[model samples]
Target: MSWTTPSDVVALLRKRWDAGAYLGRPWEPVAVPLRGPRPGELADRFGEAQDWVRRWEQVDLVRLERVRTGGRVIGTNEIPRRVWIDTFEGLCALLRVGPAARRFEHLLELTGRRFPALTGWVTAHPMKTLEAADDWERLLAVVRWIETCPPGLYLRQVDVPGVDTKFVERHRGILTELLELRVDPVDGVPRTDFAGRFRFRRKPDYVRFRMLDGSRIGGFGELTVRAEEFLAPPARRIFVLENEVTYLALPETPGAAAILGGGYGVGVLERMDWPAEVELVYWGDIDTHGFAILDRFRRRFPHVRSVLMDQDTLLAHRVHWMTEPKPTRQPLGALTAEESALYRDLISDVYGPAVRLEQERVRFSAVRRALGP
Candidate 1:
């Protein structure tokens, strides 16, 4: 009963097409073995077997191979043993993907004419090429612009006919693939970084800070500046607080300032050059991740110290304790002995299961005391 049906043949052809096998290699006659009724099946259901053979006779797209079966009930009759699609056109016609196949061929022509180097990509991703058939020309235009345009320009500055920043953003994945084939990647730029790989000017990272000493820079109490342009304020102590509210609510301390640390994004701070004599202090949640952030910050600024991330601070605020959800167990190389001990306890669940005490929950008086005269 499980004989190869017409729909099964079509599915097999489509599977090959979907795999890009048909597009990549030279067209050859494809022969699919047909599962005909066995001798027992022929003897038991001779009329039903005859009807199945008649079904294949109706389908003209494939050339059928008929083999005689020696049977007992019915005289030996021919049944379709194999179905052969003699040409690629016949295969496409049977699959009813003729229009899509023609569009893919057109894409091949266009890619060969304009970007000959990307011919392999066209063949390898025939379906993808067909999917983008409407916007194929515009996608190529973006690539052409990228090739000839001056370096260091933002993606927004890419001027091409019928192509905007949104189009580029939408098609960035495909563009990255195509561009990688044509453009030499920038040194030190990871392949996953779309902007860096193509040398486009990326969005600037901004660092936000508040002057705790009442000292005004451009007469502003709080300021956000591009990381590259960030210059240290006139302060002997810099308190990097993970919570924005804590950074904002800090009592004014003479010759001290606070920066809103961006958790793991503290890597951006490495771009700025801080004064050597300035004391850098970090205050974050008394959790494994908080210690991890401090450890990362200390990697760039070795002299950095942590405040209010101690065992005593965590124990005092037991009422504010919450589950960390996911605790980092990685050994913090830069943590001081006390910080490391606390980090170990948090990871080991010594206090409680994934215990965490957010910096914002700490008493204001304790925060004031931490910033002692």
Candidate 2:
């Protein structure tokens, strides 16, 4: 005779078993419910199913015996003992299924086999912590954003609800640390005395020079001077150059001096004190970035003017123009009407985004011509 399938017997036994446990004695076996379809109905439905039904009854008896003896019969030993459920009723309760329902044995076993892995996954990627749930949610949100958005696109689009610009600005450092993104710091001019002697002990690439004070001078190669140097006392006319080479090579301007305005170093420009009579002229590339820097500088010093940065200059040096990977969005802050129009056309790629007339690209004679005798 062919062996009967267990599913049929299991179904019959489930119909016969009492769902609820006896009060104060849940381990004890209770009589099966007789009101449901009897064993004959199951036998008729499942062909040649007698042995399967018998085996199910025997297994149920053994399970009850194990529960009564307080022997481990369900779940893994590695799981916490406090959460272990012994009886079928207890197992069902833990699984959030009906109590003592024998048909669900297969489901219970399946869950038992798969639960540890599920728990492990949750633990590895926990969305909640003791401190707060919001942090976890925020982290998840960032992950989702990155997954959905293209690279660098998220940086330009800012629309986080309930998060104000000031809040973002205040937590800018923390956000950068978490997301591993860089944001430029607010700009201000460096103090001349401090700029003259300041040197970053940790970062060898950064050096401070006192632009205002003429006392100390070091860093023979390309250097980054603070804004204070240009704005502080002895506030001579300031000549800002985008190229380090051009800045270093600047000939003496008698009473005028030069500064290396590191691209996007406008954050440093806003903090310096300018002399009432001192004039500031920014000379950067004829590219989007150069004009952007010029615009930013003028915003800080409205009287500041652009030098060697015009369409004519760009056209004349078309042969030397290099490509700029990322262009600006137009003159940023308070640019003059003409400067604004020029910046819009440049940034819009009317002359192509890659078009860049670098300051260093300009001939020394052109620089002299722009500076004038």
Candidate 3:
């Protein structure tokens, strides 16, 4: 017969006890006198004695067996008798008592990995509920905060609740230092220090010259001019030289200065604050990149003028003409009417793309003549 009701459960418990089936301790059966109808009645019929049913342990069904010793049962002779079939419904009823019933939902939600730690905390503080534990509150707070903010803004500014400006100030320095160390994936350099001070400073070889009034003047120290310095009044008469060697060789005028345009430092020129009445002039290769730089410069500073960057100069040095790999095809911006027409004819293939006249290729005498006698 299928084991049902309290009586059957008692019988099964007794059989298991007799068979020495229990693995823990010397099994002992304690007689619990039934004061009312069996626990099963209240559990199945009225639910009035549900707590008694949940707390009921079938001691009689799983009684301890005594091994024979002489004529009496010895202290070491006890063992469990046999297996007691525990139904799932009975197990569920047993677990619904006190704290276990209260924490049933939480138990169901815990994973195999998390259950042990949670159970340990519950065991250590039996008076407190699992939800009242420190770990639980911290975990909940973190989860709620994360739901509001994602991880991508780890170093970004955030306004967290209960976090004050003082707290931000405390960690701001450390956070900034960490960000400074992170290199750009594209260029593999600390992004914070990228595009830093491109210009270098060096003392120039002093050379004094007599002024137009025959008065002796002292030469100034070589100042490696940057875009900011180039914008100053002393550098108002801006002279751009394409060749570095020629730039170094040029004599400085009292108020005028030269820039070693470094090919593309022309772009840097766009950022400088030039003087309102400054006379700006560019001297580049009589070729495409040079003209393109001139074009770019004029676009930024429309008042800028080209010096000795002409077809006549290119033709005069025809013997020194060299081929350029990539010639400028796009029309320059803010070009003077004369420069626009001249540049068109030069790149039109009427002259040929191979035609190149670098400024450095021109003789010093030719440059002096172009500048002025």
| Maximum-lDDT candidate | 1
lDDT of 1 by residue, 307-328 (tens): 8988899899999999997888
Q: Count the backbone clashes (under 3 Å) in each candidate.
A: 0, 17, 18
Worst 10 residues of 3 by lDDT: 194-203
The TM-score of predicted model 1 comes to 0.87
Global lDDT scores for all candidate models: 0.86, 0.49, 0.50
Cα RMSD of all models vs. native, in order, equals 2.9, 18.4, 23.9
Ordered by lDDT, highest first, the candidates read 1, 3, 2
User: Per-residue lDDT for 1-373 in model 2, tens only?
Assistant: 3333334334544443333222212354332221221234333533333343345445432232111111233222111111112455643443334532432333234323533222232222222121222343443344334334443332324345545445444444333333322222223523322111122111113222224233223533223543334334343676767677777777645456566667776556566665325787788877777777777677667788787777778778888988888875643767667666767777777887667788899889888777753
Give per-model TM-scores. Answer: 0.87, 0.44, 0.42
Mind giving the per-residue lDDT tens digits that candidate 3 earns over 263-313?
866766566564336887788887777788888887777788887777778
True lDDT of residue 70, candidate 2:
15
Give stretches of model 1 more than 4 Å off. Answer: 44-48, 67-77, 273-277, 322-331, 337-356
For residue 189, model 1's alpha carbon misses the true position, in angstroms, by: 0.7
